[model samples]
Target: MNRQTKGVLLAAGGASLWGGSGAAAQYLFSTTDISTTWLVAVRLITAGILLTAISLAHAPQQVRALTHQRRNVGYLLAFAVLGMMNSQLSYFLAVKYSNAPTATVIQYLQPVIIIVWLAFAQRQWPRRIDCISIVIALIGTFYLVTGGRLNTLTLTPVALFWGLWCAVAAALYTLLPQSLLKRYDALAVCGLAMLVSGILLIPSLFTIPWPHLSSGDWWLVIYIIVGGTMLSYTMFLQSIRYISPSVTGILSAFEPLVATLLAVTLLGTRMTVAGVVGSLMILLTTFLQAIPMQKILNLLGLKHHY
Candidate 1:
């Protein structure tokens, strides 16, 4: 296979593994009394340790140099607390309250949220495609949540709330680490963020009861920590070497699709016709947003991308 094809496959595989992990997590939640707090804490800490060790071994000076800058330290802390911990913790809670597919699809709202934020924060009106994307997202979200009904929801209220919060956290994760990522190795930044997030959540662990895991449960959790968080991330990052990031973003939509299929097959989760249509719409928005509008516009002999 060509290099680009290989990268696309790798990226798709990584996203599929991540989606599978969510289904596995849901299975564990159904079978075990695993607490969200406990799971998030352990996943971050264990993955953080292993990743940090690997990154440190690979680039000792670079990793250590990041710690010396006070501004970098501040960024790391913010990334840990808001991006790493917040997203993962909220996502787990969302999964606990709803199915894996529901949580995964809801978090797809992050892209739309980012667009809206950029519009307000940058003090600019959204362009034509942006406005269309927003409307498409809302229509999809409406169907996903209400199942084409008014004044009621298919998902529980608490699930909806946490899922939206999960989207916000996901957006923060996407945006907040750009500067750090530009300067530091990806592994260095991510490992430290996870490490610090896990450490900061330590005190809260005292308030929550410890969880007991069976052999099977431990296996599932390991899939989440290693396969989902670490290896998947590694593969996805590597994919960017061969393909444009916009392409990678488009391929990563496979995540929710995989999650939904796994939910239906393993977990016996059902979706209404409206739900399926809504998901397609949201998936379309992912494709729309992933388009390099300027490049496309140039190809079309148009000066304006909007």
Candidate 2:
């Protein structure tokens, strides 16, 4: 396969793995009585260790860059706080308070925020296709959230609030590192971010009750650290080198769709036709948003920026 093809596959794989995270977390939670904070702490610590070891093995030069660029390291540290630590913690907590499908759909709202941020930063408006996509996505999200029955819009207030927080965290994770990426390599930035997040999460470990965790619990933790966090993130970073961020973001729509499938297959969750239609609408919106419609417009002799 070509390089771009490989990158697309890698990105899709990453999204699939991320989508599976909900199922994995559910499995772990079923096997253990671990709290969200505790789970986040453990996952971060383990992922940090694994990532550190990998960086040392394959990219020692990237690790060295951190020691030399103090300012870059500081930015990465801040990114870690919002992107790694807060994002994961908020997302898992949202799932805990609400259902996985609801949390996943809410988290998918980050693409819209990304487009808005990009437009604001560039001082331009989104393209026509993007506007259409956004409309489709918003309509879809409304239906999905209400589960097709508009009267059932009585969502759990706590779930909705935390889920919105999770969306904000997701948006920050997508946008905050653009400046740093201009200066440093993605691996270096990701490594430093993971390390910082791990360090910040350490304080929580002291407050969390540490009892003897069961064998299954330990395995689930390991799976989440290795598969959900580290591997998925590495794929995402690598994908950006080959594709535009818009494309990468759009491909991420697969995450929620895959999560829904996992929910049905692994968790035995059921959905109505309206729910499926709403999910498709949301996914379509995200995919439309990801495509470089601006470039297409430019090619077609249209004068617009997105």
Candidate 3:
């Protein structure tokens, strides 16, 4: 296959695994006494160890060098706590309170959040297309949460809170690693961050009562850590080598699509027509941010005066 084909496949596979993992998490929450705290802690620690080991085997020198740079180490620490840990915990908490599809769709708002952040940081107004995208995102979110009724909220307030927090945390997860990713091997940076975050959360695990997991449950857990976290991340990163990030970002939409499908089919999660429309609108924001400005204006039948 061509390089582009390979990248597409890799991106799709990674997204599918991520979506499947979310469904798996929802299943665990509904059927078992598994706490989000325990699951997030275990997923991070185990995945951290495995990814770190792989990085050590591949580039031991880089991993060691990273520890000696205090500034970079500080960055890594912040990324671990504020970025990685927050995103992981908030996402699962959202899944716990809401269904996987809704949480996944809400979390996809990261790009819109990132755009607003960048515009503010740069002190430049966002392009007209970007402004439109933001407005669409807001309307989409309203439809999603309220199901077109101003007085009603489809999701509980707690779920909405964590879902929005998950989006912010995910934005941080992408933003905080810029320096580390540029300076060190991506694998090394990610592995170290994961390790640190996992280690920090270990103490809390001790305080929470352990629930017994069956062999089937164990296998699902293993799938989540290995397939969902480690392998999916690896594939998603690797795809950037073969395709432009814009295309890869577009393909990442598969994550929510798969999650919605699994949630509806296997989990029997219901969605109103407005919810589906809202989901599509929100997902479209990602595409809007990616495509050219002229094309967007044309699609909207608006003249691009600027």
Per residue, candidate 1 scores C-alpha lDDT tens digits across 1-306 of 999999999899899988988898888888888888888998899889888998889998777877888999998988999999999999989988998888988888888999999999999988888888889989999999999999888999899999899999999999999999998899889998998898887876888887778888888999999999999888998899889999999999888988899999988989899988888887788888889887889998999856
The TM-score, computed over Cα atoms with residue i paired to residue i, of candidate 2 is: 0.86
Q: Estimate every model's Cα lDDT from 0 to 1.
A: 0.89, 0.76, 0.92
Ranking by lDDT: 3, 1, 2
Query: Which pairs, if any, clash in model 2?
Result: none
lDDT value, residue 104 of candidate 1? 89
Weakest ten-residue segment in model 3 by summed lDDT: 288-297
Best candidate, TM-score-wise?
1
Candidate 3, overall lDDT?
0.92
Candidate 1 has an lDDT of 0.89
Clashing pairs in 1: none
Model 3, C-alpha of 262: deviation from truth (Å): 0.8
Ranking by TM-score: 1, 3, 2
- Residue 44 of model 1 has an lDDT of 92
Task: List, residue by residue over 1-306, the lDDT tens digit for candidate 3.
Answer: 999999999999999899999999999999899989999999999999998999999999889888888888889999999999999999999999998999999998998999899999999998877888889999999999999999999999999999999999999999999988887888888888888999999998999998678999989899999999999999998999999888888999999999999999999999999999999999999988766668566889988742
lDDT of 1 at 169: 99
